[model samples]
Target: MSNPDITTPVRRPRRLRTSQVMRDFVAETHLDPAQFVLPAFIAEGIDAPREISAMPGVYQHTETSLLKAAEEAVAAGVGSIDLFGVPTPEHKDASGSQAWAADGILNKGVAALRREFGDDLIVMADTCLDEFTDHGHCGVLTTDNWGHTVVDNDATLPLYATMAVSQARAGAHVVSPSGMMDGQIRVIRDALDAEGFEDVAILAYSAKYAGAFYGPFREAVGSTLQGDRKTYQQDPRNARESIMEVQLDIEEGADMVMVKPAMPYLDVLRQVADMSTVPVAAYQVSGEYAMITAAAQNGWISREPAILDSLTGIRRAGADIILTYWATEAAQLLA
Candidate 1:
């Protein structure tokens, strides 16, 4: 019996690994340009697009450049874009009022993209106040008796609702609420429904974490925040909390849910993707992009392949959509 068993193997696991085509044919995951949602920034005061030092090749685009870049991204086969704004210091206020203004730079960017693409591309506006607030907090702040400033959840919900309505009015196809404020999704949904913007979808950042991974983003947005957002953003130490957050957002009427800083939280993404009824998206945030770019720039790794591999890994983790700074370049490469 031992001689017979050693003489013949019943199955050969390496059969699928015989060639690239064979491996690809049996591959469980695939990537497509339409699966990517590009994250773009538009600055209110810049004459031309200015590159962020920490995030090389990513820019603080002027409104004009924003339209151009968005068009290029779409032309490269990217399916959608998520817009962020960087207000001039003078325009920033305690309330981040510009965030909901009709003429707000982010609103303008959304309008510009809508006009240029005309329903050809999915235009998403970032419904957050961090870029417009002088304090750089995602919500309104108040000083407690101990002189500690904390975000007022109730006060911020109304602002988020108002900002969401403004983005919808500006022709945004989707409003992504990333502030992580409690009840934000329901509030925005109610506000949008009341204003007859029921057509606009909500992509909630349901599992955003308070991590050091957001360091490069501060520079990209010109943040004024002196402290952290541990109170609102989820703690990375807990996985169950992420599932709870996703459930709450879904019940609140989120059309989609996202896991932020995708690579680090892929397990969380997997969990969310498995249970969520709606589409699950993942954000490959600024810091994530910076690290990969930095390593590539140093010649320590191949940039293009690494980008493709990272994106493939995210897709394999079960994300229906991926918001990344590499959307355009990756889309072109994949094509």
Candidate 2:
């Protein structure tokens, strides 16, 4: 006998990977349709759906198209739909007042989705003001004594609170506050409770970083941002800071927490997921979608496999829920 240990390989890990069925059987992390959340944009005055140039397959939907998209998402068994409003340029204002209006695009979208799906689907509203504000900042801006124009954190809280209440009244099951305003969770939570919407849940964007990856998103929302949102959004260099942010949100009554731009910050997502008492979500942001789509289009990579692989990587990194533009298509594939 020629060294039995080395001759035939004593431990053949390949046994489990021998076939598709075998590999599926032994897989540690499995994806489900329920784990996906779709981010959708509804433009206020669009006559029809218009495809976003940067994000190849994604579109800025009109009301009709938005409904159709939701129908398709429901058919594909997507877990949730997070709606972002794109108001006409005329609606943009200093206070982002449209964000809290009952007739606002986001609130109306939420209402329509809820009416169509009833209790069958979870409707989420993006409770942020970036798309509505003329200045394109996430919050109210004022000149500090130093002559620097900065977001007024205290002033922004009440707006967020009111926006949350508006979303709740519009039948949203969850209101996601993507603005990184301090005390936002507590303020929104109290506002909801006081309005008898105690059962409404909050999904706090606890680790949204100010990064270059948001370019495609800015296009989709028709953003009017003059400068960067560096002061409020987390810096990309800081990972430990995300943990503190998550802790604060949880302590302040966040029902769930999220890490935005999932691919670039998988480490932060993993850390947040590991320490979080509630569910953790990761957003596969617009830029990530655009890059992957562009690369696949250029024949640099296979699209379907790349999509599945990216989602799997996020899932393996401990994301309980993933927000992505590919949610419906990925869910259909997984199903």
lDDT of 2: 0.94
lDDT of 1: 0.93
What would the TM-score be for candidate 2 when compared with the true structure?
0.98
Measured against the true structure, the TM-scores of the candidates, in listed sequence, are 0.96, 0.98
Worst 10 residues of 2 by lDDT: 1-10
lDDT, candidates in the order shown: 0.93, 0.94
Question: Per-residue lDDT of 189-301 in model 1, one digit per residue for the tens?
Answer: 99999999999999999999998788888898899996889999999888899999999999999999999989999999999999999999999988889999999999999
Model 2 over residues 1-335: C-alpha lDDT tens digits? 55555566778898899999999999999988787899999998889999999998899998889989988988999889999999999999999999999999888989999998987789999999999999999999999999999999999999999999999999999999999999999999999999999999999999999988999999999999989999999999999999999999999999999998899999999899889999999999999999899999999999999999999999999999999999999998887
Off by over 4 Å in 1: 1-9
Candidate 2 wrongly placed segments (more than 4 Å)? 1-5
Pairs with backbone N, CA or C atoms under 3 Å apart (clashes), candidate 2: none
Clashes of each: 0, 0
